[model samples]
Target chain A: MYWEKEIETMDREQLERLQAVRLRETLERAKKSVHYGKRFAEMGLDIGGIRTDADVEKLPLTTKDDLRENWPYGFLACSRDELIRMHSSSGTTGRATVIFHTTRDIGAWTNLLARCMYMAGMRRSDVFQNMMTYGLFTGGLGFHYGAEKIGALVIPAGAGNSKRQIQLMRDFETTAIHIIPSYALHLSTVFTEVGVDPRRDTKLRLAFLGAEPHSEKMRRKIEDLYGFRAFNSYGLSEMNGPGMAFECPEQDGMHIWEDNYIVEIIDPMTLKPVPDGEEGELVTTTLLREGMPILRYRTMDLTRIIPGPCPCGRTHRRIERIKGRTDDMMILKGVNIFPIQIEKKLMEIPGVGTNFVIILDRADYNDSMTVKVEVQKEFFGGDLRQLEALRRRIVEELKSDILITPRVDLVEPDSLPQSEGKAKRVIDNRKD
Target chain B: MISYQLSIFAENKPGRLAAVTRVLAKEKINIRATTISTSDTFGVIHLIVDDPARAEDALTKAGMTVSLSRVLAVVIPDQPGGLDRLTQLLLTENVNINNAYGFVLEGHRKAVFVVSVDQIEKAEALLEKNGFQTLDAEALSAIEPFHYMKY
Candidate 1:
């Protein structure tokens, strides 16, 4: 059943050969790509010269602006007929940069996702409720196709309407749900709103969530209510989709399918790859992609790579869950505070409500940060003095973490703004 | 019993006033009289409601900053001499007014004055003995189907 040796566990020598051959094909393919053609030539680099992975760092890295400038068809390396499916990024200011996938490309992605799901202890007999939407976003279709390819019965439920998701889980006896961890919390919230106990009612055993940064404190919260193990899935829309890698049962880190893709960590500032185990931007080159091939594309995500045999018996290289994003880092008083650190702290305080806003502004010459946290009035004694004291406690909590004093503003229950899409955690209004 | 009136802080923005009113309206709160004291970033709105506790509860739910302090509500005659009488009484008692706002209680035969007095219970007893009417802390917030804002 594992005839896919090129994807499983190929030795270094064999991998080098496959990568060398595939990389050449990718180079030729890139030369003809409308976006890369003149640019590659202007950069004065020969695609034929790239004989090894070390040769990749020499090529100019692709940026998000490059994709936008080229727009929909610029990055297409193959004809339309060969490409069976397409996906695009959300929030298009101009034209959307469409991602094309051929049948083989789809197969490779499905296999990778299946392997990720498999690592999380999913089975062919398991009924997976696909909660992510299937459309222009890669998250939905990527996970949906992967589940079906694994011989599992997949429920294409998509997202939103938590009641329907819960009902289907109970009716279909859903064993695994493919959704982000934050959305699963929304499900538990709905259960409480409707007076249904999630612990006693839900049949969900495992939840796979991605597309945004999360924290381990949030992981424990989801596990506590949904009665399931929450696994973090990682991927980018341009990088194919949610199957780039996934957390295994041991939950140490996500395992990248080294056989099908080449993973590297590079210092985004220095323009050189960092040594293994150092935190840097992730770059990937899909060895098997036919229609839309990405070579050493800089994925702005930051995490350290662990190159070792996984406890799950898979020889793939593992990566710790993303610590934070490089672009999201805010420099305040010469100190850096990532939104992820706030998320971790927020999760530690239960019933603090999911909605919060980190107001950022300049106080004096230094940067100021105020976290406006929402608390249920029932928790407070309806006294402003008492409420102010609670605010002080939160200020103390965050001060210990950020090493800088922050003003804690307490708002009423359900007072914080609610978002229909991703929760807006940071409201940075700094001059920078 | 002595009662205190408070001027609470609110962000200066659109819909902020409406939001504050909606909370009080939901509870059938009666704001006897009010005035917004504002600055560049925020504003403090001094108010006398019919039911202070109920209004405070509602405002708290809506996430409004509120605080309580003793203030004097003195009754003045409807004639021009009414304010003269109340001010002279406070002056004689050596009570200084932090601020003052006057509003005629509709359908009432007399005018009412809200005074940020140094002492409230003393003024209330003095004004009552002088046959002047002064609203209590609860009465100030209990404005029914309010004439202006359903306060």
Candidate 2:
């Protein structure tokens, strides 16, 4: 009944035993790398002493900075000849973090993604349309191989041709799509403008949304608008792009596949593990990978492990939706704020559209925040008073939630700059 | 009775008005009069055009949020007291005007004052009862503004 029923449904005791064995193997492979070899030698890490999953705490946490400091092949465990392909982070800020994969590593990643897609109800008969751009970014190829492994007819329609995307949906009877949440919402408008109601015209019933952290309300809005069930997917390039954790049919939380990786949530300040059900940073260690096996890699994504067993019977532990990244947290007036907080509040309001941007500036030693939201066309009745009321309502709601009064600005529909990839939601103009 | 005016939602940015005019120009739609009112970050452009329905369609197809609203186009004498007389009647009757724009058809002879109000039928009835000559869409669009001027 499952992709790998034996592994997927392995009990906790058996899973821990399997993880202990894989942990030792992963450490042995990690030791072959130049970066981890010196660190392990310095810490005198005894691979034999690591007997259980809890023993992962002994390993020093690997960070993005460490990956950048090492540069290209510092983390490659296997010989250069064994490498098949490599994916790198966009490196918009600093040095790009790169990860190499052997043929076997690619196979393991493909199987893991297949398991995830199957768990989300994708089938062999389904025609999957992958709308993500395939490049150094892992989202496109990772899911593409996985969907193909499931025997689904894969239509690799890369991002940003709303008219062509709709035409493909109609022509191919595309039953499923892998898209970012923002692009999914943006495509819904095109469906109407092109006079094709997806609910009636296309056979699309399933969508896989990932690559960007989105709210539950945003998920529901996409589902309601497109008349499909959108499954939230969580993954990073360090952990092989998008098959890290995925929502089962229950939709309670995503189950992190523990067979291939060990997951830990830790306090960012203390760098210590937080108990299950408490929010903290996600640290992961990859097993079953040959080319580059990361040990205790700090993900910087904030989420908590959902305690208790999921009704889907997958013994793997579940994780809550990623709240926000540690680096993306905005500190204003001695208070912490996240763009998702404003986005969540705006989604609940009736007249608010799918697009918004948060601008930060400072004047007279005071930091100020301004949220610009697009006014929905249906709600704009050519009345100034109604628009003013909507703006005031957004400000009040945002203040009540974020604990600071923010200046709200309403703009024309689709006026904000939109990217084909993850939406750029913040613009910081303050000179720090 | 009531004439239609195209109201467009726009951002307060450079070249936005040019973009709007480009759309209308491509469609060969003539603008009778136009008024733009801006708030902090956005503005609304209200246009009295020759064919409001066609203008709205063209602007919307060009990806602008355009809405057609019912407005009253009242004919008044092209004199200083012409608009004052209309305002006095509206003030006494408590008929609030949300947006208004005017242009003289013939200098010192006649002018058109376009006013957008919430209660269109009531405003129209009150204006007619007050002996005010209100123009419908056809008459307002057909007005020959500055036709009496010779260069």
Interface RMSD of each: 6.3, 1.1
Candidate 2 per-residue lDDT, tens place, A326-401, comes to 7765645434466767888899998887799999886643468999999888777776667778889999988877
lDDT (Cα atoms) of all candidates against the true structure: 0.71, 0.85
Docking class of 1: incorrect
Estimate the TM-score of every prediction.
Answer: 0.60, 0.60
Misplaced by over 4 Å in model 2 are A91-94, A329-432, B1-151
Residues B39-92 of candidate 1 have per-residue lDDT tens digits of 443455677777777777778656666666667766565576778888888788
Candidate 2 achieves a global lDDT of 0.85
Ten-residue stretch with the least lDDT total in model 1 chain B: B142-151
Tell me how each candidate scores on DockQ against the true complex. Answer: 0.06, 0.38
Displacement of the residue A83 alpha carbon in candidate 1, Å: 3.6
